[model samples]
Target chain A: MKALLVAGEKSYLNEISYLLKDDQFRKSTKNMLLCYHSINKIIAKIPFRIYETFDCNEIGLFIGTSHGELETTKDFLKSIGIDKRARPFLFQHGLHNATLGFICQTLNHTGPAITVSNRFFSGEDAIDLAMDWLQLNKIKIAITVGYDSLPLGLENQVRGLYPQSTQLSTGSAAALVLANEEGVRKILNTNYSINLNNLFLERITYCRTSNARTGGSTSTHYYDSNAIEEIYNNLSRYPNHCSTMNLQKPNGTYSVINMAS
Target chain B: MIASTTPAVAVTGYGVVTPHGLGIDPLWSNLLKRQTCIANDTGTGIIDQDILEQLKYSLPKDDGESASCGREKSLLMALYAIQQSMLHAGWTSLNSDDGLIFATTTGYIASWENELLGFLSGSRREDSFQEAFRREPLGTMLADICNGLNFCGHNLLITTACSSSAQAIAIASDWIRLGKVKRCLVGGCETLSMLTSQGFDCFKLLTRELARPFDKKRSGINLAEGAAFICLENESTIVDRQRIQARILGGGIASDAYHMTAPHPEGLGIYNAMKIALNDASIDKSEIDFIHAHGTGSYHNDLSEGLAIQRLFGEHSPPVYSTKPIHGHTLAACGVIESIICIKTLTEQILPTNIGLKDRDEKLKINLPLEHESVALKKPIKFILKSSLGFGGSNAAIVLGGIS
Candidate 1:
């Protein structure tokens, strides 16, 4: 099976609109839309010819989001009260799968659709699932997405872990398409595991690390881009590099996704 | 090339924590009497304060540190249901190869509500962030359930709105069929949250009275909360066939791309999903003996779902029923909860009547069994189909049946 990185885009909260190149897509998806739309915008950036070659009915979509649209969720929550209620739009788009449906409608793809979340390392899970679907030939073409947005209050909570990520209102989304044929990098093998250790909690409570600090964000969504960028940058040298990406959610569990490089 | 058949997965045991109470008996008995179990939420506040107050009384109290984190009700219900399921399946410890697929749309939202309160009031406590991280993250919920059940294998969390849990069951069965796992604990759980309660209220989707699916006087869904789990073992892995509650024939998931919240007017997604499920099971439409529909009582949902049923089964459509009036619309938990109901119907051969249906819409051609006396089938129910349609145009259908 071949894995192709068709389109990848990451937009911090400050620049999300600018990254959505299509004005019509942006206008239709602006309100009540969340991380899935960002992923759709990335998927939209892919060449139309690539989509034209395959029937939309033959394509499937799989997305992973750790903390989906925290900003919108918070907004919706804030609007609920005895005297007030959330807007119908917020009610419609607050769901994690809302974006998944929006992406399907936008692309006119009607194959199998799934939204999976494993906290911080969800991106790796999405990639791993995409490869499995391709191996099973469930779909001739699969669109995989990993997306999450950091709302306002969340940045202050994880500021210690993500010292390099100064913007609290930041989020990142990345997407790629894959098939059972040749692509940029061949996926030899992939493994994923969950580690329930106090070490993850200690990192949060004490911010302690043994080795040289690798500047990073604590978001599963932000790290989603890191994994994709790593694969893209090392596609040539990493013909057979076995590498593992470990991310720790605040819940004190370590999500490790291993790519047999 | 020849088409390959999906491996049949056996539903060894199941458990539920619903408004009717704990276990299968309570829910079944309540449904048998056509009794409506809608609870009122008169308490008005930022978080549906009364429901939380009632939860304190209804559910067992959390012992120590975790209680303060919030939304312990959902976690408690999930643990309770899983324990019952494990016991029914006659298992002690899950093998390292077993997987858990959990579904929920609102995971510890009450915990986040606390954090949001602190955020808005500018009184964010030093430990509030830690608490939100610990309690509100969906991963924490999964990890908690895994630890509670002593499971350490593959795990997946699905949040596909209302169809979440039904899809969870389908995926778990797939894992077993595809050799990814030997066994799986598949289910969905949901707890009352201010967000969805008010969201549905904003959309005016909540019925002022009891929800009546397919009834001409039907108003809307009654927002309810609960959790359910079913232990699914591969047919090849089962040591004894006598313990099988029902066999999972197949499942199909699809999207309409039609609208954000409303279903396609023609019920296109529902039709596609049901058709795919029948194909996956390698059965003709004539084989379906009964259907457990999504039936959320909204004007559009009922109409769309009814149209889909009519188009698919036509005159051959078997008995149809909706249990939301008895259990309320539990959203994410509806899939597994409703699937468990189907299994019980297959075993008992007594279908639950459609409660609160004073009048049926004449325009819809589907057969909805309304009278309690006529609910039970004279012959054994062989196969049952359960379906769910959620927000974002997501849809899922699964076929289950008595042991072959």
Candidate 2:
């Protein structure tokens, strides 16, 4: 039932400009293009032998985003307001699941694909769902991505809403390739015998602070969407150890990810 | 029916707020009467303003200091549906460990449009614009629902366009089966907005006339808006047999990996999803009494789904019907809303007909109930299948069984 983190990649702000020049991503919207490149990077990093074991039919794709296609949505809305007509392409690409479709089509992957949103905790939520699918033996491998592109003229608005938020002002995407023990063993080839415990997600927990006056709590915290990349960095740096990373926003809403070798 | 080894998942309670009216009573009655709720001029199904105002007043007032205040219409609809569902479940409050999975395609889009339009025109005040921007993110809807209901367990907001809510139900059922939670609240909410209607119109997917599913001259979909929630629990957790409404036999999800707006020409993805769902339910195709199709009345959607149905069930395909002609297509909310209708179908031993069909499309070659055909089963209805397809090639199906 263990989900091993086999490969990962990330892109932040200007680092994603290279995708804009690629012909393969020319028709892709910003968020879709960003995710496409990130997933490709993860695929490229996988060993040839392991990559050969991937079953396109059994691979699960999970995407998490705080504001999906906001930029395209704005453009579509503008078209409606000024021209009194909206573009069909913009309307199609403006959907939140458009990125999921784009990735699956480009990769020729037919699997269980879903897009989830939990604000700042979207990354963890995506990873958690991926892990559950793996644990349930539903798929051989899971590609989980967390992505968000801030809409134009909305950065200041976000900052005003969450003054202490550090990562909500920019656009970024992070991806992880996870597999169960049996799938990982088969992918690595039994002869290679790579340690399955090098790095794997052990657990995930989401917590929110309760309000005493209202008897209910609101999620006002905004945390980094690329926290998964940070977890990847920590696990790689300190091998053969257990690590617990606590990600907390100023408002006391936080999530914890347990990684172990 | 095939035997299942996995833990049984039960549907204990359900509620809805559709254009037909609030709750299942009005929707069922309207469907039986073959009523079309879409407005002729607007080509959309709109909920009454008085019902909305009454729902708003029934909800607890938000304290000014809370960030969850100033909610959008979609979130308000979701809260009202949740209220109805909880009350139907005979629970005054939710356990801290209960989970929630929400689905929506356009989250606060109307509010965002208003704010952005004002900001661009330079005629609106900045303070008012800022207030609108605060409610922009789709996740806020999930948070607001949690705060309103005091639900603090596992929760997620799914936005896979039209398939969003069906996938939410699937995931909630998975959670219950895996012992992640004893019970979960699964729901979808969508409110009419200029972006959706005009956007679909741009694609030429909106009907100029009435929606007619499986009809030779059927134009396209009639965009609509609503919210629905169904409470799913582990069958072992339910102590009262009278509380059980139906059993969630199984669910499956898959992507077409085809065009962004168009489904696979042959309906390969839809067929695979239905097959997987039947397998998950551990049942043979013959066990299903009928199917609630994602028949949007759009040419491509109806043809593709019909082909999928033909491919799966072959010559013995069960009677298929789409309620869009009655309630219009509610986009993301159709999955759960139609699911509630399926529950009613199983419990009542009645089958709804495809309302606006004047002439069946011969190319489909699938069994479709005729307009004005009212089918009341002499024996108990056993199982039903509900399927949904989204704009991004997302497809999902769920199997529900009547209580034995």
Candidate 3:
């Protein structure tokens, strides 16, 4: 409907099961919403969004990453006046593929939301997987979500790769609404390859920041100062290299490369 | 049965970032001198002093620069390892559509969490991974290494604890063997994490000093961090020029159906893993020259692993050693790292001594390379077995062979 799909030649979701439908790859809905309280919460929240209200043909596809987050939608369930299961369905659906199950629970799309990941590119690869399926005319709409709550390993590897995105050590969540379009923002037709040489690193330069939602930098030097020269010249290497390296080691010092501006 | 015998996959290259050191030069050099790549970091990921103040033993930190810190922000190592492996696999000389299979248990979670925390706490500014794959999502870790690398294949993330990387390699090998992929770059990455330190500490499963595995005095494990990758190809495409490290005989996966954290205690799942692996390779347990066991210096695991080996090998169990104490438990990286180590041992014809195993545990009478003694094998050993058992009773064992 909105996003046109393009795909690489080879992908798991490309092959068709029958001449009629396409196969989309996902993170898995194996344990979608394990209990009933979460189901009550879902039932309660059913009124707010247009997704839940509609009969569901226009928006051809809907995908969600995980079902549960910090707040188990507990209050909403109580408001709906429903009983919680012995084991919270919120927690069960709270596992990885709960959201997709939620969509499936509501909208009757006969297609499948296949879960998959190798690490890192679950989101993009999931999109690619869906696009490959689309090329095979798997489905018309594609919604992809790449989100993770704090897992056991998240805290340690942060100092090295993603030193900027963590907020209270919470997991990252990303979802994109995509559709197989003949004349739209093509999701397919792009040559996707994982190259070691093409790794991208983001550099942030603060611009006259005032308190928005979250506050500004505490470490003054790289604060909201209006000077690009300081960072461009690399005039001073990072001052706090404390949490950068071997961050996994117990008390391994974070390096100066942290909070890099 | 899921894997093809005499796999078409060729291990083109390997990359390692561990306390044993990062890069091939340091790792190989340390191997020759028989030195250990262990060190201390006092920076930030873990407040060693603070934890020591609270917990009995000091916790490991993210020291990306220290030998013990080999697995942090060093994207160059990943690049270098890939380059070196490609060169060795003759991949550099030729161009092929081999996919890169990057794996990690703690894949950049440490770096990502702290930075995001700093941002959320109103301490720092910048939205890296969030910004990178705004439309999509990225890393399981705090840092977005996966997006950073820009992988576009059937990118996979296998996080079954210690078996993470090995499973990645196995799948990559399968992709090539099954012709699902041409060539595959397979490996794993893990950095130290304070949370992991606290989690392990909470579980009371660490040693005060450096780890001492397989020793009567072995207390607990020293959790290390890092990454390692090996390039693999189809044998039909590769000529038998370079001496093989160890043939990847067979690999098998089976769930314990037991516990979330503990092994079956009876070693049921692990036993089947080894047996299935041997059978898949069309080899017998007796043919195994040596075994690289996942001897994390824990009470239940060592005994369980010992039982599994005894059950499989009976009286003729080959020499086995766990390098955990030597290079702390590298978590997910261990699968590929240990496999590479097995390759190194097979190619060099040496069964490395278990670094800290001075004395053996009384109840466990399994063969361990406890000392720095080299065995002069008259001929090249064919099969090398490497096993990795993760939490949730997930067991995976891989057999590597084709030694000439």
Candidate 4:
């Protein structure tokens, strides 16, 4: 594993209120604001020089939402079939790519922005997409985000899939700005683009059976929050140390983020 | 940005399930006839209605799992297409070394909608949630295909608005070029859903009447559904050269970031994508014989694409046409479906006419063929550029040429 650029992270939707509680909030619709809030929270943390050095066209964004804007979809459909009043705003904001599109527009970033959904591994998928693009030299800077709200309209339908104790909250999101390790000493190894389940199983087996250390030290941390913030925040704590954290999403997918120095 | 000489990706086999019918022959023949297939969707909100009824008179009764409901139509169509492509390529099985990348904007959305409607009507079943959960993840769609085919390989599902499958194909080619995989199955699948129909209607992006691309009075897009897949292999992996339909020379993708729904007025992203594709192919702008434009009949798309074409080809532009009217806009599936059109055009020496363009937009400077023509030329088509622009300002272009 090599050192990777760790730009920033966002743990909660409320943490982004600073970006959303402005005059722009007046003009935007509800879902639009929600999306912008989530995206803005991440990009706002990236160094200004990163944006300045790379042309907006050279930056990419990969976002994953398990149930993308379900409320908006439900509202649009219900309005059309039952209420007989179509809200164009809801329709526009309901798309799975709506947040990705908004983020591009917000930063004027022209590089390819992709939206991925993989049940519970959406966040890991976004990270995988970013790492692939970065390693391929497809983009200089990649902004990866994982966000989802409680399926308000379809809650009762999907709740059974989750453990009853799972705390699936509304407006939960996390972001990571990943870049190539040109001169940076810190590295983030995603072990990306592999069968995530098999990889998780292999890692678990290795951890349980092996006494070998990957780096000078090895440690495992488990966080209660699925925000990915814990991983980001703790990466700095273990400088020059190899660490791996397995995050269990409420939807039962384990997202493993590996960091090595 | 053109790299040194590299191996070209060959399209060995293709399968298309379009409104015209099953098989590439049906789609090609219909396109050659210049028939517009757009009609008022009668089964839009009905869950049990076979959305692909327009494809044929009736489907087989004993097809078993092959029979598709509105929601499963995309997967079923994709499976059929994949079966055809694999057989065409003379492959018995795909192991872990191969790759499968598919794209779609809607996966089981119709089923979820039905569940929602049922719940709203107080007719929901106890297992409705389980059924919906099973179909919720776009990844599950990939898993279903993988398990059904017994494929143990790297599989990726991309959803980049309208250009999802196009990007998927481009990435698959990149993977093959980079030696990440020996062979790749690339394509897209989409099934009609009320969410898309009403959503597009709300955006005013759907035309009330028939879709008319590049027409002076063009209104909006006509929504359609279908699935298409192509087997791509590099020169090293290609077993029989005779089966090569077309070769992917190069591809490029760019984002406009100008607007979410609207494109850059000057078509900067479109121009960049085409330019990069040409550069990547190491071909001059003059070598392109034809363009399969992403003319969705929307005013902004036509204007932007026309301007981009004018800026690139200037005086000696090749014939440009849109197949959206024939197939309606298949959304994510347009990339592979349109690429198949290009392959057929090169293979059969036939150029499809641009339907629904009675009167060209004089304001937009470009040549659109209103009548089908045979390319019975002295030589095969050397290069054809295909372009697809999506809702999020994502633009992708690929340069394809004859295998020879």
Q: Which candidate has the top score in TM-score?
A: 2
Model 4 error, position A239 (Å): 3.2
Q: Recovered native contacts in candidate 4, as a fraction?
A: 0.55
DockQ of 4: 0.41
Model 1: what TM-score?
A: 0.84
Model 4 C-alpha lDDT per residue in residues B276-388, reported as the tens digit of each score: 78877788988898899999999999899889999999845888888888888888888999999899888887777777778889977776765344334555677899998
All DockQ scores: 0.41, 0.56, 0.05, 0.41
Candidate 3, superposed: residue stretches over 4 Å from native: A1-261, B2-7, B40-74, B93-96, B119-151, B243-245, B372-379
Tens digits of per-residue lDDT for model 2, B184-229 = 9999999988789888989889885789998999999998889999
TM-score for predicted model 4 compared with the true structure:
0.85
lDDT of each residue in A88-124, candidate 2, tens digit only: 8888888788888898888776788999887778888
Scored by lDDT, the top model is 2
Ranking by TM-score: 2, 4, 1, 3
lDDT tens digits, residue span B201-296, model 3 = 545567666566666776666777656778777767766647333456566655454544567776766776787678766787778888889998
lDDT of 1 by residue, B128-230 (tens): 6555655655766886777656567778888889999988887787778777778899898888777887888888788767788999988888878788999
lDDT of each candidate versus the true structure: 0.69, 0.81, 0.48, 0.70
Q: How well does chain B match by TM-score in each candidate?
A: 0.91, 0.95, 0.82, 0.90
Which runs in model 4 stand beyond 4 Å of their true positions?
A: A1-3, A17-23, A26-47, A181-236, A244-258, B1-6, B40-71, B121-130, B372-379
Q: Is candidate 2 or candidate 4 better by TM-score?
A: 2
Task: Tell me the tens digit of each residue's lDDT in model 1 across A104-165.
Answer: 77766566788887665566556666665655555556667766655565555544334354
